[model samples]
Target: MNKLNHDQLLSLEHPFVKIPVEKFRSSLRTSQKHIEKEIGNLTDKISEISKKSVQGSMEPSQVEAALEAIVNRLSTLKRKLKDIRADEVLYSQRTKVRLQHLQDFATIQTLDSDEYARWSRVRLNRIVIDYMLRDGFRGPAALLAKSEHIEDFVDIELFAQSAKVEEALERQSCAECLQWCKENNSNLKKIKSTLEFSLREQEFIELARERRSQEAIAYAKKHLTPWQETHMKEISHVMGLLAFPPETKCHPYKRLYDKSRWNDLIAQFRSNNFALQFFTPEPLLNVTLQAGLSSLKTPMCYQPEHRNANCPVCDPETLGALAMDLPLSHHFNSSIVCRISGQIMNEDNLPMALPNGYVYSYNALTEMASLNDGKVTCPRTGAVFNLTDVKKVFIS
Candidate 1:
């Protein structure tokens, strides 16, 4: 496999840059279903009335009543169609604005100085806001976004919607979550998601744990019964919990009543919702940082003695710690820089190896020699060497 750096991978496959066609399609599908159902009902009613007329059983009064009803249905259908058209136009305008912002990211380098500054400010704010939102620091995120006036670029509302469901899940209430599941029931079923079933299971467990035997049983019969075909084994396992008391020493049943299950449901809901909306599971800040750090990481960065004070990858406080798990950049050829001159040792400025195994560019050694009576000192070790003794090294 060809190893691509984070920048390349993100440029090619970042979820943020991708158009949310699935989300749009999902909304359109709901509207299409409603419109089709209405048309179907209207046609069926018309067909029935026509059959009555053909049978010669329709009175004049019935004719007038049928005509009024048909006109009313037609009017309602027209209104619905008009509303859908308005919604479509509104959605298109919003999508175009968002697309314009996304395009700016790609063409930012081509912008003028003032434009670049404004874009950079918005981009930085967006990254910070994204990180804050993901970490549940919505108060701070909202403040920062409002102050910066970048709310339109950030996904504040999207995160808030999912956060509400998550908060309900945390409170041990599956109501909002279940409603969300119902709204996206078709998509969930298509993906064979276990989220809804899991939520129902948690509900049953909660009732059983509270010793509400009758209520638990009724809940299982109504909510859990539908999951039998796909989750029969799981259903059997959970139903067995009722036989054992909530305080029973049985490990399996005890685990079912664990409070951590709510956290699990919250996580599942976030993951499923993010997937549905085509949002990345991780914060964009973390993703961008990882990519940047990985591109700068090297084997020497881990060694304390070889560390550079100005190097981010060598600073243990922040970036270094973050880049610990990242792979080093792939380099087919080695690069050496002069310690004294801060210049690369290439064909023109050849590297000179000292007796102490330290390397410096020939130009740096020459400059040091000119000042130190033809004696060069190694920056790291502080060892002195005659310029004549420093052998020129050639890198293959």
Candidate 2:
């Protein structure tokens, strides 16, 4: 495979290349925010300690305690910085691997090479595992990741963290998710996210649902009042829940108390978490498949008579269904892909039509003939033909 110079590779706009580049850039931004926050906290602590000393209130024990606090804070900062460095290394390695995959495609003479096949298999596994992990199929995802030996390449552990929050939400508890929001409070606030406020509002609504009016009021005063500037209207509606019971059919109040709110919260948290981590909220598998199937889609793919047996867009059960709404790929001329070998038919790999009127690539037919006593077998119709009887097909 030929190596791609950096500029040329970046100009191609391939999704495989684009995704990693975006991820690397987002991860850097997240890391920088964390580092800056930590450093600011450390500076604040040191300044507080100095202010006390200058005021002559720094007793020996107090000084000792302050020093210990600073030490612990510094240790935490150091550990976080180390983790950031490790993440940078891992992300850099993966970025290079993906870019190399792009470079490999540049000079590849044939798609049937072992190296190309391996890369393709790895990509499929990664996509499947990613989808599984996001959709709460961790058991199967883990098994697949283990089998493929790509534990490092996939974000299993990261998704596992999200699963915990999602599970908590399913059980109608917001404690775990609230803690996560707290942990990422700074990042979330930077985006002007309403997630934490929404969670708090839900908690207030739950208190109201239980008919604990006093407790609900107290919860609102404590947790909901702080968002007055940004969410005053929302907070007012939630507070109205205190008057009406859960069974009330009031417009906004009833809607707020709907059971689906929990599901919405789960989705909200997942989106915010993915954003924080610089990952797409949608599964990579879905994104990749949609992109691929769209490119291969054509109007003829939907017609039963014109559909090829091996066409992805013709398989009604899976790929076809995905491509149903996708726009067809723009084509100046149609391309024929062999049903047997799954390769495009061109002059080099000429299309050969058997007596049965089914077409396949010459390379596929010749190979099949060599293996089957000088005869070619129709994969679609099960018709057998002598290799000498096949005719080459030409396209204008």
Q: Which candidate number maximizes TM-score?
A: 1
**What are the models' TM-scores?**
0.73, 0.64
Clash counts for all predictions: 0, 0
lDDT of 1: 0.80
What is the C-alpha RMSD, rounded to one decimal, of candidate 2? 7.4
Q: Candidate 2, residue 372: CA error in Å?
A: 23
- Taking all chains together, the TM-score of candidate 2 against the true structure is 0.64
User: Residue by residue across 1-396, what tens digits does model 2's lDDT show?
Assistant: 533244542343344444556656766886788778877987887888889988987886897898898788778877877877777777677778776665665554445677656766877797788788888899999999898887655777777888989999999999999999888888899877899898999899899999899898888889988899988999889988878989998899989999999999998998898877767766777666777898889888988888766679998888998788889998888778888888999989999889988889999999999999999888787888999999998777
Q: Which ten residues in a row have the lowest lDDT in candidate 1?
A: 1-10
lDDT of 1 by residue, 90-185 (tens): 555546665676666555443445656686677778788988888898889999989987665566767888888988887889999999999888
After best superposition, candidate 1 residue 74: deviation in angstroms? 6.2
- Model 1: clashing residue pairs? none
